[model samples]
Target: MKDIRIGIIGFGTVGSGLAKTLYEQKDRLRQKTGANLTLARVADISITSLPKEYSDVVLSNDANDIFNDPEIDIVVELIGGMEPARTFMLTAIAKGKHVVTANKALLSIHGKEIFDAAVKNNVEVGYEASVGGGIPIIKALKEGLVANRINYIKGIMNGTANYILSQMTDRGLPFAEVLKKAQELGFAEADPTYDVEGIDTAHKLAILMTIAYGLDVRLDDINVEGISSIEPIDIEYARKFGYRIKLLAISRNHGDNIEARVHPTMVPENHMLASINGAFNGILINGDTVGDVLLYGAGAGMMPTGSAVAADVVDISRNILAGAINRVPALSYLPEHIGKPRITPMTDLVCPFYFRVTALDKPGVLSIITGIFGKHGISIRSMIQPGQDAGEPVHIVFRTHRAAEAAVKNAIKEIDALEICSAPTVKIRILNPE
Candidate 1:
């Protein structure tokens, strides 16, 4: 019946947002949850000085202050990395403090260890804000859609990369130019490798895959391909063929093995996810009985992400007050009920392909390319010559039918080795979700 004392670690963007939201909506939260949420301690490296509201509440440069506090009920970790964050969360769990975090990278990589620690300590760990920002996709997977077997999940997870690629397609701007604009808008980090290189999306997908399918998939196991290699010309050609380029994170349970990959995919223009533009994130989940489900919302930001974190705080408060057992398992499924599946390798994945090749603008070149594809048993669904620049290289686009990824790679190697070809090939998976 007393207030739940909260401590926030790493008061950066999301942490500060949580603190401000707690103060701004205190009255409403108290009325709804029947328990007051109060921030008793805050930790961050950037603070030359702490906020005035927390003058009485302990403030520290070291995050251990939260773990050591006897009154703190929940320790929220917003620090976005493997180090210190992992150690801090573990320390909190060891101290019998409920752990909540928005750190996807840390969770994706070391989730098993963290979850085991929580279970050992008989505490709860909430990570609703980890995957889809404010979308609450994690809760949906854990609670709302708990009955259905998840067949597949596809999502646009990285806002910066999505924004850049979407802008490039719409405005016909070069990738570099669009990325520069995104950087200026504070949508991208100084080192955008994590976002642009598919690592960020891969991390989120790993967490989703584990929860949805109850599989333990490491980050290295996921086949990751970023959108940095996408040329503006590819986008134009894709549009000509009624497709849009998007960096998608896809996970599927394909009976034999699990397919988890993050890459720049050629999604059909009419598909619902294709219309998801700008910085918004959308997830399409295929359930056995529920059919297709779509969840879209603000993927990132101060208030949006903070709202998710706050919701978890309220849920924890209610459960603790009612003496209800933690109904939701840490990884969606109960620990003993977790399924073990092998991560299908890239070469084993079967999907349609969209490839671009630079070849000499001359007769018989197209025939030779098609000949090699046939030899490798790769059937071409369609082909296009997107015009030749004045004295520049000729661009050819090919839409190939579904085939083993190994065969596609072999075909591309054979085509690249042809005397008529000018450069390495560009291949993007074509996802035709009807």
Candidate 2:
């Protein structure tokens, strides 16, 4: 069997996981792919964290050592971020070395440049582990669903945020408390802003949108809203309405325009996405020919994510054995075929909404709120006004029919400015997938 020399940069969680997979599954990979994979070198600042078995593998403090080595055929970059990883990958491509990475942020931001370099150098780039870990969603989109036109994609992409939200929903805990528990369980980073604020989900959505629609979408284009402001009362109200709240990354193609957003969404309790809890992930995709397909699995973890990276390695290995490069276009479409689709502004997008207003228990409060909704051309489908003690700020909740986001925002702003309203209105978009 032909031997494939591999080099890894970044010996962090994912990097160590990849090493473990390479060490334990080497024989199985050889049997499956007929390629003897060799872990030639690993580049990390501290080699102390790596297991002792990897001592035989070449270790270096600088990543340049791996890039400079001519024997290394595949460079797996697990060191996430926008800096040296981008430069290192470009250098590897320039040197005609294939790349496999799980860095979603780098790819979402600098994919076009990196893919261009790979094409220019006639090398393959595999990133199956970038999005849904161990779910094979990348391969499903690029290969399995190649024949169909993808209509839309919705997913619970961030495990950290999902875990927090799931805990809050299950235990009736608040966001802060659940977030602390998530951090204690290692589900969240010390600084969980990226995951909790929807940036990470947006990064993954950008990658998925590019592959699904062949659009040059960027993370900045996605409308992002986090679950930081989601209250236990809001969750309770959603449960009362037979729905569950999930942080969802959603994208829909409308031919001339596409909608991409990440936010806390209320989905029907029976929906497949609603059933997904804990740190697991589920993606629901719609296509012209396939109708709707759901892919569910462990979204992130050592073994699951490492298996995904190894799968990408095997894919590149097969391509190498066949003497083919750029076997599939990096974004699932030829560069020339990629068209710029206008991203529909969040203000113009139409969706049902859930509104919570805390207003002084005085006369005409409901009338004023309803009048503002009417002024904005918003139609309320249903409302709840639970009994409140005298002279207390009463909670009023309304579910609106399909309305433009701009109208809803304007109405909320006007209502919040009213004398009777105690706090800014809470708004959560309601998602009822067809």
Candidate 3:
């Protein structure tokens, strides 16, 4: 069998997991692929906690050792950042080595540059572990769903946000409380801005949209909204109206345009995505011929992410053994064939909305609110106003039919200026049926 030497750059949670997988499953992988995959070297700043089984493998503090090594056929990058990871991967490709990475942020921002380098060097870049963890959604889009024209993709791409929302819904806890608990449970980072604020989901969404739509979509094009604004009252109102609230990353192909956004969405109760609770991730993809398909699994962790990285290694190894370089384009479309579609602005988005307003329980308050909606051409589908004492502010929730986002924003501004209103009105967009 032809030997395919592998070098790993980081020995953190995922890198350690990859090393362990390669050490334990070497015989099985060789038997299945007829390739002798070897874990030749690992480079980390510190290797004190390196697993006992990998002690025999070469270790170095400088990543350039792996990048410059002549025997290494593939370089797996588990370092999660933009600076050194990007530089290392570029150097690896420049050295004519296949690259496998789990760095979503790096890929989302610098993918085009890195892919161009790989093409110039006549090498393949595998990033299946960059998005969806262990879901295999990338491979599915590249190979399995290649025959169909994808129409849309919606996913709960951030597990930390999902876990926080799941706890808030199940326990009726507020966002802060649930986030604190999530941090204690190691599901959320100490600095939770990326996960809670929807930036992490935007990174993953950019990758998926690029592959599915054959476009060069960037993170800047995605309209992002966080789950920090979601409240217990909104969750209660959503449940009362046969819907569940989830942080959804949505993208749709609109002929000459594309719609890509990440925000808190109200999904119908019976939908499969609504049932995907806790720290799990679910993706619903709509293709012209395949109709709809759902991919669900653990979106993060050591082994789950490691499995994806290992799969990428095996795939690249197969290509090496067959002497086929650049078998599949990085984005599943030929570089010249990829089109640049205009991104639809949030102001022009047309969708139903759920609104919660705190206002004084006066006779003319409802009339004024309804009049404002009518002025904006936003028709109400349904509303709930629980009986309250005449002098105190009460919660009034309304569900509106499809309307332009600009119109809704105008109405909200006008409504908030009213003297009878107590707090800023909250709005959550509702997802249309698949």
What are the per-residue Cα lDDT tens digits for candidate 3 across 1-434?
Answer: 68899999998888988887888899999998998889999999976456677766788999999988899999999888898899999999999899999998888888889988998999989998888888899999998899989999999999999999999999999999999999999999999999999999999999999989888888888999999999998999999999999999999888889999999999999998999999999999999999999999999998889889999999999888887777887789988877776999899899999999999999889999999999999999999999999979998999988989999999999999999999999999999765
Cα displacement (Å) at residue 255, model 2: 0.3
lDDT of 1: 0.88
Backbone clashes in each candidate structure, one number apiece?
0, 0, 0
Arrange candidates by TM-score, descending: 3, 2, 1
Task: Work out the TM-score per prediction.
Answer: 0.97, 0.98, 0.98
Candidate 2 off by > 4 Å:
none
- For residues 2-119, write the lDDT of model 1, one tens digit per residue: 8899999888889888988899898998898888889998888878666787576667888877788899999999988998889999999999999999989998888989998998
Between prediction 1 and prediction 3, the one with superior lDDT is 3
The whole-model lDDT of each prediction reads 0.88, 0.91, 0.92
The residue ranges of model 3 lying beyond 4 angstroms of the native Cα positions read none
Q: Taking the tens digit of each residue's C-alpha lDDT, what string does model 2 give over 1-434?
A: 79999999988888878889999999999998899988989998866455689777888899889989999999999989998999989999999999999999998889988998998999988899999888999999998899889999999998998898888889999999999888898999999999999999999999999999999888888999998999999999999888899999999888989999999999989888999999998999999999999999999998899999999888999889988777788889999898776998898889899999999987777898999999999999999999988678989999888989999888888999888888889999999547
Model 3 is weakest, by summed lDDT over 10 consecutive residues, at: 47-56
Error of 2 at 371 (Å): 1.9
lDDT of 3 at 362: 90
Worst 10 residues of 2 by lDDT: 46-55
RMSD values, in order shown: 1.6, 1.1, 1.0
